[model samples]
Target: MVTHYGRAVLHATRHGFRVERPLQNPQALLRVAVGIVLGTVVGYVLDQQMLCVGAWLAGLGSMIPHQRHRLGVSAASAVLLCVVGPVVGVYVHDVTWLLYVLAFLGVFAGGMLMMFGIGLGMRAIIMTILMVALADLAPDVPTGLTVVKWLALGGALGWICQLLPPHGPRFATQRKAVAALYDALAADVRAAAEGGTAPQPWPGPLLAARQTLTVLPQFSRAAAASLFGLVGEAERIARNVRVLQTAEGAVPEIYRAQAAAVAGALSDVASAVRSGRPNAVTADWSSGALSRTRSGEAHENRVRDLVDALTEAGRLVDVPDAGKAADSWQHTELTLLHSQPGFVARGLRRLREELTWSSPVLQHALRLAVAATIAEAVGRATGDWGGLGEPGHAFWLFLTAAIVLFPTFEHTFSRGISRSTGAIVGGLIGWALTLLPDARALHYLVLIALLFLYLAFRSTGQPLMIMWITAWVSYLGAGGSSAWTRTADTVIGSAIAMALYLLWPTWQSKSLPRLLASWVRVEGQRLGALAAAWADPSTADPIALDRMGHEARAARHKFDEAATHAESEPVHHLARWTGPELRLLSRSVHEVAKCSAMLTAHLPGPRLPGVPDAARYAEPLHLVMSELATAAETGAQPDPGLTSGLRDIFGAELADTLPAWQPGPDVFGRVTHSVEELASAMHGQEAPEHRIRSARREAH
Candidate 1:
């Protein structure tokens, strides 16, 4: 029977939505099952009584499933729903039209405030109204008028369900999520690092994880960015391999084999990336025997293709011996920390997480308080707080309640809108059920079934769970009676809730640009430290490098969040940035990272003393290297002064090159001619048939 409501959860778990936390939670399961048992017993009691009574109370019990130990808040909610709603229904009974008007207002008011854990805010309030109406017209004297008692009982029952002990261990979700990510990542990186692992490895899990990682930039910006970059690079490499593979009939055999090897390596990286279980990754270099055996095959198409891509990557990235670096790789237990350069790079990446309300109690209670306030306001507005129907001494009662329960300060408008709608609808439904005269038992069963079904379907629409509650209450209030009234009550609640939320609003601070700025500021400091350490020779900066991995992972993640938000939002909006602004941000970050990578490559290790040669000057090593970095970071041309300063600091001479790369024969094509003239000057062999410079690089 619990399967009815539990089906959604079952499906979610069955599909294995992986996360860092372990999936097993025995304690949570216990809590849910107990709550179900208790709720069922209470439901059975109500079944023994007026079937409508069981339905009304059961609707209230649903709240318990989420808020296990928050007895006070849940009880308060139940009281508001069961007692106040019914009293209002009774007092206004003779004037059905006036009562209807009041019910509409109440629902509208409830929806405006906030919503419960799940359903649409408006729907919940309207359902409360529906329940009250039913109890009001019942033959039995309305005990629901004793709001205090009913609310307390309902609240306790709900709380019991919420606090049920889980069947699984804690942090299961967190561990699993983290593990799943690393497992994929490890496979990809291992193959690339070791060389020629496999081709056409599956990427389904890795791709999905990539998408998830995108959403978590603030959580792990550097890692996220690096991962995404890896994906992009892998895809590009893989595609190139495929193109070469497809043209094999006409292309040289060596080229085909080379392409295959490159494709295989790229595919490995992609696959390793899938297992993002950081702790599980292991990187091992192929042994001497393996490397020696591969030397002869190096001239083959597969080896050549692989070498080409790897060599190109090293040259572009400015990482020395990158292709050969894989030769010395060793296997170790995979961890995200081990994946990156090390310490200094990985620094302080754990910050910048999305801050949910720190305490679940506070979050839930705040929403409830807002709902209650809206309910009371509308109750008073409709004169539901006055006359015989009104509870005795309304002002004092409200004052006391207000003192005890306060709404959240910042989320006032949004919360108010959601809760207000839910409450008003719930109230009317309860009231109408009092008027129902037939098939009460069947109505209860139907309401229970509908509740589960609604929970299942409500993924996106009114996910706040206002409508589901509203419908439930309508059943309780009207009980196999008028469907039209329930519908009216539900709509009224929605309208009211929307008004409350929109009429007055508070600013949502912690804007994206600020988030972006914070990431840059923190990452810059860490990178600077890493650069300084790496630049110092005779000092092994292993630890510093290790830290860099952390900072890089974090910074990349944060920057992504900033970019996504800044790119999407116009500067006209408060605390927002335009696409150009985001580009500027992106450029700065790219340059900064490049500088750090360069420092990592050149600074940390022993450098053989040698003067800057004429060839080095011709390349303008400092200036050429700094161009992309400067363009990215500042969104401007490289400052000549900065270039001059770097050259002086490094004791390097500038190399001469064309002013710019252009398609015309005079610019890039001229440079290519010069390069071809000095072909041996390039250490890595050039692809004999390649003509990159001749192609004339266009403006990026």
Candidate 2:
């Protein structure tokens, strides 16, 4: 009795149950839990129910990932909620039409704000909608001042909680992030020494470390500058290790032994940095052991460079004065950080870019706005037509639709399913709890426990988190019929979201090519920068190189994420590339990035003789990449001449003039081959293996 449709249904349903690994921050969970409990106690003492809810919402809103900016972010969120809540509440009270208009505008604005970041935008959306629902539910409109006061108190309490101990001192998050980078580098080095594949530098931890440092208070600039110096040292160490890893196979046994030693040293440095005990690092990399077996070969030189970089990193860790003898690298990083636009300016720029109708963010915002408006309208109509007990019954419907709708259809469908299931199950649990004797103390304890569990398990899965949230909300309200009403409303709201997505769906598959093209273009820019650096290191802007590398890495991440979402979509025909082809393109792009990084690691020191032919070859190659990107985006046949030109440039005998520190012909050959493979995958044909092999052989 098994059917194809049944299998498809089962496959899609499984996404609802997918559980990710739980978040590992016990301190953060504890902080959120304490904030919520304290807020509840304050509300009880003040005899103000709205104050309790405001605190709960504020606690959840302040749960941003950037711990260093927690207090500031919490304050900003509180101000936003307090200002927006009362204005919307006053305008929507007892006006059904105004409620719908405000819901649409509020939801749409919140969606647009997502470009700033999810931490702020999602909280704004939820709080704004919740206020709108509260306006509909209240018998009399509360004054704007009263609303502001309650929300401000809750916000203040939440912000104060962020100052709690156990989060470590200022720059703690930055330090931890930098420490993690060292740990990851050590792991990669160990793997490479054991004959594992050459590992790419993970940009995530490095980026996080840099971002945290950027946000440090001006008063902490000295310490932040020192940390920035350390971060640069870590990046250089990573690059040199990557180069060493690439050459490990051909290196002598002495070099491999040195690599093993370096890995151990790196691990110790990580531990030292994490523990703030630089003196504890006992690995003496400066020992004469390396001098005994030095061959002065290219591989030996690379190993030596790696050792030097590691020694510098250790020295940076031990430096006592944070701002003493700041290097050019630290100054450059700090200047860039200071030169960056403020949050408002950056957000406005992003909003302008996303205002286009073709933008996914804009489309999602429109969908959410319309969907929320419809949900509110239907809920209101049903309440009047079916004699639903209260206007607030519609709040669940509006809330579910707002939360469940995502940019992509697959996400919306999956989240809708999870929300519905969690609500139904949680409603049953709440009903069971209601049957017991009423005890305020017991209820408070249970609420606190549920809030903690919800916060702790938030990252585990949407279903589980939503289940706890539903139960907590249900228990917070009058029980029995209210629980059933909320559950039903959730199901209806989920259905409404699903229906709206089905009606006007944005398929990730259709966007895959565009994302892939953007990634390719960014990679090409990085390659061009690398070429320029190799052509003339003295004239090269290290900041520009660093920025391009970051851009390339970020673009690649976005493409990979889009490809994953596209894969889950049922409409495969909408995509220009097949799953296997997309994967091949991804691998090729990664190979290109890795080879560029390898070359970057071996870049000649400033004012050194540079590769003259690099700039010459890069110009045409850039054009070819641009054409390839265009072809990928437009679904048109690429110019065969472009590939031939690249092959010719890569195949030319330029190694004779290349600096010894620059990457060899083998690396260039790999990069060229990756480009060829990427083009082949996009064009739906096999790569020209004979031509590639000939080019690679000629280059060697």
Candidate 3:
């Protein structure tokens, strides 16, 4: 795949072409059909149109799996929507200015809240509008109550569907993500073992498997913990692979067999993850030179340990080790997330930080509110002018605007094209369905087909998704006539969304500098935390250090995203030019991360003379980071003087300390060298070919 930078790489796609998603969850279609059919039947038996809305809502629910932790939240959101929709529906008929005020307030508030978390963002926004619009159909208090009950019934049925399925979209993503990581790791190991060269840094597909844990509440605590353990193990294996590659020259010929065995095992694990089968391959630690070599004991041991880690990783993937891994991993999560003593205070502080004017969250929330308000005003104006007899004629327009106007320009603009085209296709299909004989039976059958197609293409193709959903909405709203209006509303809303984004775009080009600076600063802070921990193990909170490391990782991810976007921007000359430098900086951060991970796993390693005082290392690193951040902000090369000074300090320290250090890999020295290259790259200088090769070896 030719990937461009951003949330998703926008390949040069042919207009009007549809690409189906390689959807893994085959049962998803059946679940949706069952949920919708069961809900519709119940509504019909109850003799309530509101029940039909509930049934449709239930079908929507079946699309997402609700876990134990999220069940309450989902239920609450559902009930809130059901209750609020009917009240909004009745009042929308009122001519008073209060109605408009209420509409704006409700929508604006919801839009802002959606910006706060990924979980709530699009899902909450769409569902909230759906409930409100449906409630407006019959604006009486009794009708509202009926809608609520039916909606609740439908939601319950969807939750039930979740309970019935083990193989789900989220889990599949997690599996594929893990499998991809292993593939990268295995390939890197193979390349180094065969080529006798440093491997490239592993490109992307970086631990997104963790996303499944965050997004899917249906994942049990044990399952989440086990997956977390597997991910952690994968990280460790990658580090060890790098270590082996670094010591590749010292490896005796005998170690090749072991390396080969490890590679095969890694491939097996990847295959197992992809196929959801057992990982039967195991690493052969005994074959390594560690057992026979007397001179290169350190190198052999490093290779031996690499093989062992790989073996454990294979076991974890196949057997889970749920009892110990789950418990330990759970504790790690809690410690990382809730390390501060006062939870409420920390939460408040974080919220305040996020709500600041300069914060991305606040900026996005404000943008969304502005866009939604404009959409609503335009929709209302069109409805009044068009004088379409139907009371909610313009509601679809508001929905389209809200749905398509994502936070980023890239997302919003892409969605506009996809959604507009999808709406037309769905509209045509809906119209065609109405023309067929026995329209009622055909409508139900067509609805099922649309629902199935929507589930299949949900994550892959935007155009098809839009079409299926619009078609589904048309059948539910007015059987067939509503389809034409749906398409028109979508086109108008998409135009407005695109225009809004273009007018006040959040260009990645402009954000890259700040993002890069922030990333460096966070990494600096993480380094400081590690230094503090090393200085006083008694005072060190392992969990807190882990949290800092996680934060640094997240910051690096953001920087990469910014770089990707910057690379694709029309006039982002600096971003385009600095691509190689950005990549080196990324590798440098990874090096720091590896150091942190190494330190965490193997503490009490020989601390040479100069390495004893953590402050000595920490203070210089901090200075370099400050200089790098400054250079990033000013768009200047980092000063060569600062780079040389750090290099001299590291060289002098290593020369004085290495002889006294116990016989093992010089991890501290390794870290210092990486930082030097990192600083060099920050100054707009290319890293030395040797350093680049070594880091690249690790990366691959």
- The alpha-carbon RMSD values of the candidates against the true structure, listed in the order shown, are 15.8, 4.3, 5.9
Error of 2 at 138 (Å): 1.2
Most accurate candidate by TM-score: 2
> What value does the lDDT take at residue 57 in candidate 1?
45
Q: In candidate 2, what are the lDDT values of residues 1-700, reduced to their tens digit? A: 2353244335656887898877557777677677778877877678554565666666666665443556666667666665566556766677877777778888898788775556656876776676766675656655645765776787667667767877554466677887887877777777776756435455656776766665565556666565677677777777877776666335457556767777787778777777676576655686654443445456566566667777777776666766654534454455566346655566678889999999989998999989887887777777733543334577678888998998865678788888889888888877777776677667666777777878877888778888888887777775676677778888999999988987888887898779878878888887877777778878888888877777777777777668777766666666787877777676676667787787787777786788878888777667777888899889898876567666656656555666675546766666677788778777766577735665896796
List the candidate numbers ranked by TM-score, top first: 2, 3, 1
Superposition TM-score, candidate 3 onto the true structure: 0.78
Which of the two, 1 or 2, has more TM-score? 2
Q: What clash count does candidate 1 reach?
A: 190
Residues 1-700, model 1: lDDT tens digits: 3442244224323322222222133443334334434554565575532322423343443433231223443444455554555556555645645654564445433433332222223334534453444434443345444443444454356455654433222222222333344344335434533333423232333333433333332434332333333433333333333333322132354443443344344434433333332322232212211122232231233223334444333222222332343333321111232244432232223111212454223343344435334533444454422232422212211221222222222223223333344445554554555455566556555555545534443332232344455556456445323333433323343344333333322222224434444444444454445434433444445545545534564555645544543332212244333445445445445434434433333222344221223222323432333343333334344343333333332332212321111111121122222222212111122323233532543321
TM per prediction? 0.42, 0.87, 0.78
Cα lDDT of model 3 by residue, 225-328, tens digit: 54455566666676565555444245447556556666777788887766666545554545554255446355444555566666666666665455455545
- The lDDT per prediction is 0.37, 0.72, 0.59
Where is model 2 more than 4 Å wrong at Cα?
1-12, 20-23, 39-51, 78-87, 142-163, 172-180, 190-201, 207-223, 252-283, 287-294, 315-332, 384-390, 660-663, 686-700
Ranking the candidates on lDDT from highest down gives 2, 3, 1
Which candidate do you rate higher for TM-score, 2 or 3?
2
